[model samples]
Structures are given as structure tokens and as C-alpha cells.
Target: MSASAAGPDWGIFEGRTLSLLHPASMLGMAALSVSTALLGFQWRRQRTIGGEINELKAQLPNLNGAKTVSEALAAAQSAEMVDTSYV
Candidate 1:
């Protein structure tokens, strides 16, 4: 098929000129604006999430070692046995 018969070619920044009111230029400007806004939003969200993760890390107690399930159960039982008056 001929180039004209294919379809309307939507080239990025095509037919741009000094004037800012061109259709193609307006479309390009709009696209850039949308992408910049989206990127800024994503950056702020990630920064907020990073701050929250740091706060959570600071609130958590230090871990000594990993314990088996049975060992954890025994510890819980010992503690419970000593504090049966509260139950």
C-alpha cells in the first residue's frame, strides 16, 4: 500500500515550529506534562513509603537468633506457667 493510504502517521514532535499553537506541538506538550506529573507523583509516593519503612524499622526490636517452633512453644509455655494468675 502507498504511504498516504496506510494511515495518519503520528510522529512524536513532528511538524514542530517556533509557534507553540501547532496541533502536533500541543499534543507533545500535553504528553510531556502528563508524564512529568506522573513521574513526580511516583517519586513522592516512593519517598513516603521509604519514610514509613524506616519508621517501622526503628520501631521494631532487635532480633537475637532464630528459634525452632518447638523451642518457641516451650518458651511460651514457661512464661504462661509463671503467669497463670493473670489468666
Candidate 2:
């Protein structure tokens, strides 16, 4: 059969679909996907860092001074400030 006589072949794209064709929409979708991926990575990193921090805190010798969570946070903040200032 001649090429012109044959009908257009849609079989190639049968199992696939184009959800976004417009330039703006495609760019927006790409940006959203990248943002979501970065957010997921950051969340995972924060979770890992938080676990490490908790583990380290557990390993430290307990001071009988701070009983409340607020007091502990304040002490940690103060220690961080002094550490940073010395650096």
C-alpha cells in the first residue's frame, strides 16, 4: 500500500496520553512536580535529622534542673546561642 493511502497509525500512543500540551501548563506542572519532590526530600531529611537529635539528647547525662519541655527548649536555645557566639 502507498504511504498516503494508509490511514494514520494511532497504535503508538494507544497506551499513553498527553495530559498537558500548553507551554504554560507544562511548565507549571513541571514546577509543581519539582516543588513536591524537593518538599518530600526536605521532609525526609528533617525526619532523619530530628531522629539523630533525639538520639543524641537521650545519650546525654540528664540534668535535674529542667523538668518541663519549655525549660529544656530554653536551655537548648541558650546553649546553641553560646556555641554559635563562640564560633
Shift of residue 51 alpha carbon in model 2, Å: 2.2
Query: Which 10-residue window in model 1 sums to the lowest lDDT?
Result: 12-21
TM-score for each predicted model, relative to the true structure: 0.42, 0.37
Clashing pairs in 1: none
Candidate 2 structure quality by residue, lDDT tens digits, 28-86: 99999999999999999987998899999999866558987778888988876755565
lDDT: worst 10-residue window of model 2: 12-21
Best by lDDT: 2
Clashing pairs in 2: none
In lDDT terms, how accurate is model 1?
0.70
RMSD of each: 11.2, 12.0
The lDDT for every candidate, in the order shown, is 0.70, 0.75
Error of 1 at 45 (Å): 1.6
The per-residue C-alpha lDDT of model 1 at residue 32 equals: 100
Which prediction has the highest TM-score against the true structure? 1
Candidate 2 at residue 66, lDDT? 95
